[model samples]
Target: MATEELNAIEIEIARNRLSSIAEEVGSALIRTAYSPNIKDRRDCSAGLYAPDGTLISQAEHIPLHLGLMPTMIANAIAEYGAENIREGDVLMTNNPYIGGSHLPDVCVISPLFYDGELIALVATMAHHVDVGGIAPGSMATHATEIFQEGIRIPTMRLFAAGQIQSEVLALLMMNIRTAEKTRGDLIAQVSANRLGLRRIHELVDDWGVDGFHRACDSLLSYSERRTRAAITKLPDGTGTFTDYLEHNGLYAAEIPITATVTVAGDQVTVDLSETADQVDGAVNCSYAVARSCAAYVLKVLADPTLPSNAGLTRPIEVITRPGSLVHAEFPAPVAHGNTQTSQRVVDTIFGAFNEFTEHLVPAASSGSMSIVTIGGIDPKNGTYYSYVETYGGGQGANPDGPGASATHTHMSNTKNTPCEVIEREYPLRVERYEIVRNSGGSGLYRGGEGLRRSLTLTRGKATVVAGTSRVATRPWGLNGGGDGGPARVEARTNGEVRELESMGSLQVGVDGTVTIQTAGGGGYGEPEAGR
Candidate 1:
């Protein structure tokens, strides 16, 4: 009769049913997206939230996107005014200043209603290959302002009265270089949200809208309680760690990322104001990403098992100087800011958490997750084109097993494109993809192995961008474990090697070997700690 009146078995069954819906949402989005990042790599997230923006359930999508949705939703509602949102209207935006990471990561949201009453918001987010920026792809390292970053869509209707708005679609087409592919992806997102919404409404029919809402609240509150309990188990004190970047895009500036964490029983205060100032380049992070990175540190170190909701975030607070590298100002090119800085920020948080619980947090991960943004004419169709892809490195080792080979670190939940897909989509061939033997750090539990991939061009021209770490500093292991291998990229232009960035694009005529080697993760504990 009532939510609390249900027995434990009843509650468990309800939870599973809700989980099934989350899975359905994920499947629909994955099936609908156009890019490898979503269709195969699965670089997206789907979740069910209470009307008040608390997590009810989520499909096991990405760790990063899943973690940020609740906060992002709250901010979105505030921007659009929840009361003004209509039943058949959908809202979309990629404003980093509001709550997104970058323009490429566009989010679409819609309200679910039954009997003319609000039930929940069905939301889906995907990373489009291009979002109409200065560069063909939105990830431009040379551009120093947000204007060059890409399309910045404010919270407005992409769909209205259940019909696709032609004006909104036309505006997108007018700005982006690759209008067709971008428009296709946009339609796919709208479709995914509608599918998710239909499923949510079905859920309401089974559970009643009010009952569903109440259950969401209870689950999120429960998650908060569980996380607090875990925090209380740890010692109350302060911990800190610092990491560095190779350099800013403009000048030779080795940016420093410092995280100071105060663990007072169950609550954490993460202060990043002491870090280096903002750059004249595109290495600045928005506050949403900065907060998400802070939350990521907690997930890796404190209690990953704690349900991912606003409740788990209740124990943590992230403080950054408004205009620092970690917290960039508006119009500052931030396309690459969050990914580059957040990786080090996660490492810094790990460094701090290591002091509070040495057994839980291991050494650093393969520090670099590079991107290769290619641009040129599509050889097959002679169309101007751009593609942004991810490269995998080795992962840090843990107590039970070694890290996986060739993986994306931190917030990334994307997969490497299948060789077949790469061949079909672009004018490049992945000459080789293999694990680099002995790349893992040496320990009882060795660090994961790094990878090496060779890209050969068949097109008239292409750009190969590299953003790698461990080229200067290797992945540091914990306790007495050995460090992982270094990161290096060699470009043989008629057989001449050159240096690379963990985050820059390159242009090649044809038949170029862009060799990328990723760093491995750090090991955990002393070699004999497990023994």
Candidate 2:
């Protein structure tokens, strides 16, 4: 066989093997994780990267973490250089400033070695149940500083020389409310990494490492070429768009996130510098998180066929001003930036792109629909439980297809823990869980609808928490499409509703009935026009 043929074959083998490695890691995480967050809801991510900290491939994971992997790996190498790393060492961190989105999404880094030399890294990050913060579940929308978000673990070794770092593990276990579960997930992350390392070795044995290395590089180069071609197809011009966050939950001020999108010679630059400054709430975001959001949006709206490596990000440059809403400062709260601001950024970009390529972008989605966690025990068993569920609204209608109903459109790939799983795990009973039909806007492509779920406590008392939006400014439609409705929660004592608008953290208790009413998405083109 020709040398070129061998090289090409080897690279293809490596690329395929890398995807296989991700799948293995994801399976191990799902099977081992104890929390519904990881097991059922799948609020987790796993990926493989080259030795130089370039993301090669990711398992079927969320968009937020897929693009953010390079930053996470880059920080891991920055904190602990290659020389300091040992064979069994696994690093972990959740610092947003230091290449992370939020504290809840913890990144576990493991170095992979072939022929006794570091060739790659395997990583897995999950939304931990708790990480010791001002809030019980670390949703800390009230947080004014990074300290209030959750535990900040700089890049540190979870395992040193094949042995668990007991000191670090013990300190982490002692913090969160779900200590036992966190410990298991922590070790499970390493186990998943180990599994990937083993699979890579198997691939190396089948074919020489030379081919595998070539394949990784080829995959990236191919992706870059494809992404550049996609850029060339966009209309060459500059367009600006703006969108607003209802409030910082203060009923005080409405901040606007703006994007000036310039497409020049097959390149796009999204500048968010004109956006508003950081406000008094936890709505601020780190530069890495902001870029990650931009990257995610482009990947979704532009081309999912691209490799999603540095190559794909080459044609796109995201600019944000420091201390602005996009670039948050120290001691400034930013937990909601990952969830709330991410959607706003996407919408802003969509709004900009809508002018250039109207048919490409859809209407705005029901933004910021995160899970509300409320759980604890009275006198029954003293075994406190933490329960959280994601509530979603309608997705905006598109020119071709109507939006999905009662579903999380973007930034929400998680699933609601099943009724059987909820009952088996905690002292709770799901009374009502169904779609809120006809809530969609009337249009050519009817907008997606929202959902309504009711849960009743079978036990004594359980605390429930929530962080959702689209209740204030409904989803906006494109062309003449209609808007998505509002979103709110309801708590009842003896079947009588109590609070209508509340962000329940650990302050509220649920004894009997609790119902949550979510919103729907907006329509796209005018129904009459399309007709």
Q: Candidate 2, residues 1-531: lDDT per residue as tens digits?
A: 123432456555655677878878988988888888899988888888887678888887777777677877787787778888888889888877766777878898888877788888888988887787776667766666778767888888888988988999989877777787788878888888889888877876775577666666677776677787887877787779988887564343578999988888778898999999988777777777767777777776668666666667777898989889888777677777767777778888888888777588888887775567766654466755677666777888887899998776676677778889988887777898898877777788888888888877776765566666676678788888888777767777665677554234434444566777777788887787544
Q: What is the lDDT of residue 315 in candidate 1?
A: 82
**Candidate 2 wrong stretches, greater than 4 Å:** 1-14, 249-252, 493-496, 502-506, 510-512, 529-531
The C-alpha stretches of model 1 lying farther than 4 A from their native spots are 1-11, 525-531
**All models: lDDT?**
0.75, 0.76
> Weakest 10 consecutive residues, lDDT, candidate 1?
1-10
* lDDT at position 98, candidate 2: 65
RMSD of 2: 2.6
Tens digit per residue, CA lDDT, model 1, 1-531: 235534445546666777777778778878877776678777777777766566677777766577667767778778888888788998888887776777888888878888988778877777787887666677777778888878788888988778889988898888887777778777787777778788877777887866776566666567677787888877788887888877575544678888888888778899998888878777777777778888877776666676666777878888989888887778777777655666777888788777766567766788755666777677778786766776777788876677777888787767888988877787778888898888888787888888887777776876665566667778888877789988777776666778675556667877766878777777655676553
- Candidate 1 clashing pairs? 146-331, 396-521, 463-506, 466-502, 467-502, 467-503, 468-502
What is the Cα-based lDDT of residue 115 in candidate 2?
Answer: 77
TM-score of each: 0.94, 0.94
